[model samples]
Target chain A: MAKDNLLGGSLWDAYSNKVTTLMNNPQHQGEITEEEAAAHGNKLIVADFGAESCGDAVRLYWEINPETDVIENAKFKSFGCGTAIASSDVMTELCMGKTVDEAVKITNIDVEKALRDDPDTPAVPPQKMHCSVMAYDVIKKAAGLYKGVDAESFEEDIIVCECARVSLSTLQEVIRLNDLKTIEEITDYTKAGGFCKSCIKPGGHEEREYYLVDILADTRRQMDEEKMAAAADASMTGDFENMTLVQQIKAIDAVIDESVRQFLVMDGGNMEVIDIKNSDDNIDVYIRYLGACNGCASSTTGTLYAIESTLKEKLSQKIRVLPI
Target chain B: MQVYMDNNATTMTDPKVVEAMLPFFSERYGNPNSLHKFGTSVHLPLSKAIDQVYKGINASDGDDIVFTSCATEANNWVLQSVWIDNVLNSDKNHILTTEVEHPSILSTCKFLEEQGMKVTYLPVNDQGIVEAHTVRSFITDKTALVSIMWANNETGMIFPIQEIGEICKEKGVLFHTDGVQAVGKIPVDMQSVHVDFMSMSAHKFHGPKGIGALYIRDSQPLTPLFHGGEQMGGRRSGTLNVPGIIGMGRALELATENIEATMALIRSKRDRLEDALLEMLDDVMVVGERDNRTPNTILISVRGVEGEGMLWDLNNALIGASTGSACASEDLEANTVMLAIGADNELAHTGIRLSLSRFTTDEEVDYVIEAFTAAVKRLRAISSSYAKVGPSPGGEAQACDLLYHHDNDIVVKH
Candidate 1:
């Protein structure tokens, strides 16, 4: 149900959606019903080869059918993220169909190989294969139902950080909610990339990709408007060096767009060029203000003097200029 | 629509106290500070009133009492007297107080610490009570004072002040207990233990606001809180508020006269209200050691709702109460006292303090209970996620599944 909610209200909603989607997918969904899951009879088999103890493996155990395991069950387990979770998840599935002999054969190598087929998987490490195989053996032995000799009974997953489960979903949620655009932001938010600094090194995953259809459309529209405006400017006022200050003001006023009009309207005023006069080789713009600006106390403020100075700076005086 | 449950902040002036104040405010108003026959006549009643307050607290000597504007002022005068005396000129610079004490004591200790004094904050147990032994552990030869509140304003949890006072006496340390909430509601005697000072406010027990008294033991040397024209025996300054003093004295007299009957009635109402709330709502924790609480006060934290919003709803329905400490109501960092007592963030946010008086009737109790239940339900319905976790009336349960047998079929649904 949560998976159907694409645009969630909060970041937690996004997490719920992702978790729900992972649970519903048939591959990760083990072949067992919840009613069959009994807590007492079956031995507690943990898949600790994952990232950390609290994250993916624990979540998988919570979502998976408890009754499905014949002897291997995740009463306790741990994992890191992405591949480690996929590895443990794959190990859990492989254990469901086989007896103790065939189940123990499913190692980290097999889990990693199996995860390559999953759409969520990016890359796999060779050492994770050893972790998966060792964890599987431990689970078989811990259950006490497996008739085999193994190194350890329970899976060997170490709890590095306890504050956040620091598993796959935890880091993913942190990244998504915080909008971590840089590795520094990710490290600051999750603290996963900070500690031990093993799996979370830079370039471990490619930069997230976003679709740019809106960006392209906006760029094209802006370019077209700019081209038309430039064409009009070239045709109306090609050369302004030799024109008188009055003629120059008329040329510039012709191109005064709606932006200036809207800006003046926002200030409860408007402007019209009354005269452009020359004074001692400088051009001054004389403008008649309308509405509030015409009789306003601050009329002489930059509104008139700044405009005249800016015009002089842009178009050098052909002769003396002054405001009328 | 004013629903004020911030009674600990200050109660509405009692009508009886108001009536007593009116006559003094107009006619019969003479300067108690003056030396004339009219002044003496006013002074006579004022002297009798101070004696009455002294008797109310079971003080042996009348001279031990001093009337102040309010409890905070009394507490300040009592604690700051040590500083003014310059008594600890050579040694004894440490002041010990509990972590859950009111700001009057806590902030005063902090201020004293800034003045080259050491302050040891005794930690409290989960119940917000500092053991007498803990207070002793913080005391040393240099310890100047040990100040603890008589009853917590937020939870109404009574501290073992008698035992603490004995310990302070044994250590030769001055003990100043803030008895603002305890003086009128409960029996307090300044002479019973070797307490050097204690503070009380009239409003907590039905007097007008801005009037209180400080019980200063004669055995302890005291310096005036202010220097002025020989008022309040040169211990406190400024013109005496003759009307306010008379009203406070009267309030104390009234509270003590009906203390037993008032306690029984409020205890019954409080118990019934608490029982109803706990039975109706799950995950509600009654704060403090319930058995040791004052009869008229109940501090509870309701899960899955904001206390401020719940208080607003209760106020709309004319039910008065407070959340956290009345002084800390505006702060959202969660009650520091609640946190000091080991309450979680959720409990701190949802804490509601219900303090009743003799005026709380049986009908008001039932109305409050009903209003509280309705408010919790209403707030929960509007919350972002909790609305999904609880079963509304006519809805299925939220926790787990149930099975039903229908004719020839069986069905199970979560």
Candidate 2:
């Protein structure tokens, strides 16, 4: 059925004509037998993959000439929505006549783009993007079956930058060793996040478990802690009471940032130092709670004890913490 | 043969209604609030339209009907105002409703809960029917209002609103029903049922869009949702939509005039389609009982085939249908009615609703039955689960044969 013939109204307008055609009459919707492969001097592989989110599944059939390493024929049977069927059809079409290695390189983007009637318009809606991803997965499954290996083994390393083949450990080491701060700096040094940029953060074309933005932030925080630890060691000798108020505050802030802030932030709470005053014989530190810490009952008891004990151990033994 | 089976979403405006509304838009265009003769001339038709609405619902002359933009506005007005007058001003602070209500009521109840009101969303049974006893059990001393829909838009299961209304009356609590799907499809007599408020949308019946009415029982206290002009006697204040009012008035009149005869024809056609589909397909079940639901609705679930997949096949055949509620179609989530009826996750996604209207013909129904059956067979043959499970006990062997052939064919050769 063509797009103009659809009577379901604007909902059908979301799909391109090519997708609608393939969804209704998929060109490669069938299976290949082992006997057929043997007669042609080829190896047949069948692999099935299912999507847990929508219960959609697809089975890919490939007949590859092992001697030439070229895929002789490709077919697929999809058990999902129309988008999934169209995606699998285009994916199977793209796999034929290519080598086994080349077939594995066909990404979900290629499948989605091939299904589009025009180069600019999307073949399916955004919510249906996962169907093309499912198609891409089944190809890897079929290729893995023929190669006698796990489908996940195709990507042997955690390649953070797929375009440059940069691994996660390589990106982390580069950031730490060279003190790279911004994404532009990382891109300039290694070109890890330069192409595609999906490895930079979330909300991209592909979801990455380890992004360059997070890796850089973690590495920089470790470097800051290392520097703070060195400073603490140098200042630990009995210079607490001899230091001026501003100097003492700065030293306390550094210790608090290293020891207390992370735990407070994890629990959706935080506090800031208001003032430091000398009350009679005791040095008193006044603190105000922010966010969830403001009305918490434990801010008076357990939290107060932790803050007072941390200040006593890190800075001056005579210091007392009070919440106002 | 472009068949439309998504009538619960909206209906086509009757040509008669269009003819009635044409004069108000051009020739008799006047603000009803003005004191001029042109404005005064509009009052006769406006009041006649109001009378038609009152007669359509069998309401007494003492009852009040305020026209709103749509049922969404009418529903919001009742819920929000009840929250202010009963919950905020008085000691009553609890609201009781069902889990399978339209989003207009459920979302408003959720908003009220966030504003410190206690709400209990009563669950429905496996048949998607909420028992009146469940309503009686959930009501407390602090219960302010019991809001529920007269008929579900997805399953078309008519709730026991009459019994539930009596329970609320006995308990001295206010009751409101969202009648967006029930007004013209079923008999709604306000003189018999003891409801304090009811929301109605004209488009759900054959009227034009952008017009609806909220029925308020005589002398019931309600905080005005809008505060401006004295239109609608200060209940809802805006310059009257004269054309929409005229269309709704005439639409409701035609809808109820031969409703029993028209609905009987629609019911027979709906039943023929439903029965034929159930007999032809395997692993298919209707969501609710035929007799308990409205006259023209069938929510069927086909195992091993997705709702969107079936919709695509139907659309390719020039048929228009919906998967579950049309409002939640964009998210592709499982149907809320199915989930509330204790269907598993997969079955929830398989439920498709096909609603009929007065405009539906026997030919359209027959065409849908044939098209839907063919779609099911084709979809099931390609379904991965069907291939694995084979078929249900005593299932049609032809469908299994098709599946077997589809799985074993050597279509692509080296």
Candidate 3:
């Protein structure tokens, strides 16, 4: 079956084997017949949905048992690329035997995950993620028809590619997973820019709400920030010898300025960390008084207690703030 | 069981060209520049290959043809070298070209622009055709070259190269046409057209890939893009791909010899397919059909159906087609040619470019007509947007067009 790939060679290998099989012979991609529905004595629900950006549409057919409110049979027809057909086929398979209530809970990610040949690998590239999403939406559309609700009630994520209906979290996860560097790579993996291409950037075919370039860049920036913050936390909480002078100062200064500075400022008083000293009994932070607190009495009592407690709670429990 | 109609992407290498190339791999395989007879004996065929290219394009002198790896290299050679030396040396670094040229030319223009060369990408009319006068108006003393394609790859629209050439000469500006898609498929009189530089690829004319030729009219002293041993008369240098050159020569000869017969066969089939499709489908655009575009290429845009979905259905029906140029990235972009003509993104996205060759048969053509029609019908049936002509009546033909059938008369439009 692999050898029969009409579009041959390493180029066609981008599509998974399950995807190819389903695309070539979509087993569940036909409308259920009226006679078959009548014989089964089921109430049939048909739902049609079209993506706004790409104009790719799909029709979902469900034959539900009126007595049990269970979807007895499910079928679909997709008006999109091979990925869409394959996705709809799998979405139909996953809908089988689920009660109307249970089937509505199925999501696009669930549809995509079900097509994976292995659990660890992606079922489809990021560009094709929307096909599974479209597949997932059609089910909601059908369920909505059954329950007399709008299809939008089922969607809960911010869609990034309006044309493909690809959401932000899905794009972020894919960029992270595949290490997608460019908008073109994102388009290849997710089909986000495959249609109108407005999602690639602004001033393309049209205006888009969220472009792939911005999403990829924004997500990458957050990832870098998170990584730097994690590295800082690890070193700050380590043993005294392990903390570099810069890290120790940064840790103390951050805690004092952010947590204790406001209380001191209100009284026309302030303190600065002179040095951090570690002995056998306790770790001590040396501070110098400033402003009105230089000769104040409560500065040594409540003020000192407040500063030491805040530093201990934030940086380390063994820490002390000393006024000299 | 498939009708492969995307000939512009690549062709089935002519069997006769392959036959001529067989001996070169075993018996006559030798470097043309070798001192010994084993290699020197290959010189005669090499000379003949160069001669065939010259004769095919009507080059005034055989020496003007310099074979490169492909048209991309040739295009880069003309635009980049001219900009660096001629355009920059004179402090005149502008290049004039149309928006609808092949990417080989357009992408090279982009690279040149990034390198600080002033470029004007002139727009075309609704027919996807660029006029010579439009090019003339853009040219200045700073104009390095007017690089336009003789014919577009996406819509198969042809530019007025001869008229443009006359204008360039009068303005003292050089002209280079990316004739990769036009040569061998059409008659090219280089001298008469007054083109300063021209690029052609062998693969586009049923020859082997990785072999291309550039023609320099009147032997202009343009700088070389390739530099090595004095191969290609020191203009381009590297060891010649002997087998590929021989194959290109043979393919060009065979394609040129029966050019009229090939044109007739291809044009009739193309016209037949285009006419049948236009007659049947109500919302279809035959891009550049009214223009004097290539006879063998037919671009049809079916309203309401996106390009890749139609291609998927066609692939399912065992038919090969394309929406845009093959040299383009794998992403689904609307044809730039269509865009140049001010086509909205919808029409551009719906374009299906089907180019033919002499090898195409009437049976294959007829089969494609049906297969493509059925694909459009199938996609349009499930498409909710393409045919939103309000419930005008529903039947087998109009069901997908006017209404979609359901098991229980539930024509739900969510």
Candidate 4:
């Protein structure tokens, strides 16, 4: 690949796209009207923390803020992910300079409710309430006061969810509302995984492939090669609809073997069939090289592709070719 | 916290090395180029440092160690010196190198080829090991020099340099080995190997970058790559990168002192990681020869996933590893090393290189395995073809959406 195709334009252009969206969003800029500032007094400081990928802090910030209360000298900095960052930036403008007491009362719920009401913004994950709560906590802390008794340890209150800043309580709330069943679901609800993509998946399976129940047993049953050879030898096993899984694998293998042999033999090389393992959907085969391919740089690429492309055309889409 | 795993790219300067170099930049700053007593006094530590590096490599007393701005410069001096400067540049000029050789060698070979030199690219086996015979076969009568790497940067594959050098010597041709990645990490004795020239980069083995040495055996009267007033015993001329040179000496000494224990620790960790990852991801393939590979390095590929994406996800999780080097990331090409070892490009792209150092801890190793497993599983989830048939509902749909869309809204709810 060329450098341009790889870098996809300079990182400068990517940064520009991000900055342009930030500068454009009115909600992100917030309504910094003098009247609004005067009405809010010093209670308003914009607690602009991230939501989603930021996790607990953003949530806790939002949770602390129940309403769109203002705070004095209120500006927040966050280089958070996408819409969440923009939302936090907008939320900051919305809450600037009312008073400390007022700002502490605002919550992620209010911000999300506001986001949902705004047509331009996408659906705010129920979890984003945590971000607003985080913003509220920041305002309260900055003011050196708390409306509620300081029962939780600072570490306890400090959420670990830096992306969305969703607090422990906020995560629980979002989880309950969405009936999230897995860590993936939990991530979707609270946006704890929006940034790093660290939402733990169920189990440790490197791949999770789904098959319709009816086809699975049938595919597994077709593993025997004599049965597959019979099916491939049968003239009616067309397009693999009537063929067994083993038959399809063999058919694909036959095509690949022929193609690989043709290409390699032409190049003073030959391919060795290493191993074939049958799975429900695909047969994985590993190949070794003989002749020119043993030292050739283009052997794996050119020779393997010749094999794979030939197999892909002969077999159903399910068949895959792998190299040793 | 910012984690640095790209040590192969360049290491953070050791604070001790920094402290030692500080005075030379300030009050004690007298150019060694000067003839004054102040300059002459500075020569004591500088010469001692040079001796330290020489001692670390176990070079003979007669061997001439010449420092350069970097290993690249040193390599250029050793390689192109015989050709361009020493009157060996001709169509008959032949340079032999292993397929897994670094860009410094590869690019240099490319430049030499453009200048009409007949270059022979030696092939490495599936283990990334180049046999001695491979060099022997390429050694024509016109072969000027055979350049083979002491240790590969990506796969950490050690070559049979001594055997190659012995063969070249038998043929009466000069031999040069790039020992940049090998020097401090393993035992190297130039007196025993009897090679003409070898290049070592300070940074690759934990020294500071921008300073390296070219060990020219006493027998070879090589022409200078750079010519100027008295410097490097008139072999080359330039102001010394004093701090970088001093740092190299200290780094090499420290690394040599603990090489055995450090390698043992790395080998244990590397084996554990490889075994754990292989067990978790059953279909995954380990690259390079297990026995022949560097103890500190493990290169493995999880089938059906882009190594770059997997690496990004790992970094995002605060676990540092790479598809190859921090330098090679810009290319996004599959591992040329893996491809040379007969892995297809897809498999090569899926390759991940993990290098451990003396500084790497058991906890870090465990974290690496955990992080790698998690990230590989996650990235594999979005690799549509594999997930399509494997038994997870909606995996294909999720992977498809991830592939085609700017917004992962269909899959990631937020």
- TM-score of chain A considered alone, across all candidate predictions: 0.27, 0.53, 0.51, 0.29
DockQ of model 2 vs. true complex: 0.13
Alpha carbon deviation, residue B3, candidate 4 (Å): 4.1
lDDT for each residue of candidate 4 in B183-239, tens digit (9 for 90 to 100): 887788887895888998888777777888899898357888878876977887887
**Per-model TM-score versus the true fold:** 0.53, 0.74, 0.72, 0.54
| lDDT comparing candidate 4 with the true structure | 0.59
TM-score, cand. 4 vs. native: 0.54
Worst 10 residues of 1 chain B by lDDT: B397-406
Better of 2 and 4 by DockQ: 2
Q: Is the docking of candidate 2 incorrect, acceptable, medium or high quality?
A: incorrect
Order of models, best DockQ first: 3, 2, 1, 4
Best by TM-score: 2
- For B267-359, candidate 3 gives per-residue lDDT tens digits of 888898889999888888887753387778988878767676677668777888787521122443445676556555455557788988888
Q: Which stretches of candidate 2 lie over 4 Å from their true place?
A: A1-11, A33-44, A51-55, A64-71, A98-102, A143-149, A155-324, B325-328, B388-414
> Tens-digit lDDT track for model 4 on A196-237?
222222111111122112122333344345456666656364
For model 2, what is the alpha-carbon lDDT of residue B127?
78
How close to the true structure is residue B337 of candidate 4, measured as C-alpha lDDT? 77
Q: After superposition, how far is residue B284 of candidate 2 from its true place, in Å?
A: 2.0
- Where is the poorest 10-residue window by lDDT in model 2 chain A? A48-57
Per-residue error (Å), model 4, residue B230: 2.1
Each candidate: RMSD to true structure?
20.5, 12.7, 10.9, 23.9
lDDT of 2 by residue, A1-324 (tens): 699657644545788899888878888877777788889999877777763124466777788998998999987766677888888899999999999899988887788889888899977765566678778877877777777777778876677765455788888889888989999899899977664455778644345688988989988998788866655655666466545566678877887899988887888999998998865577888889889888999999998899889989988887999899
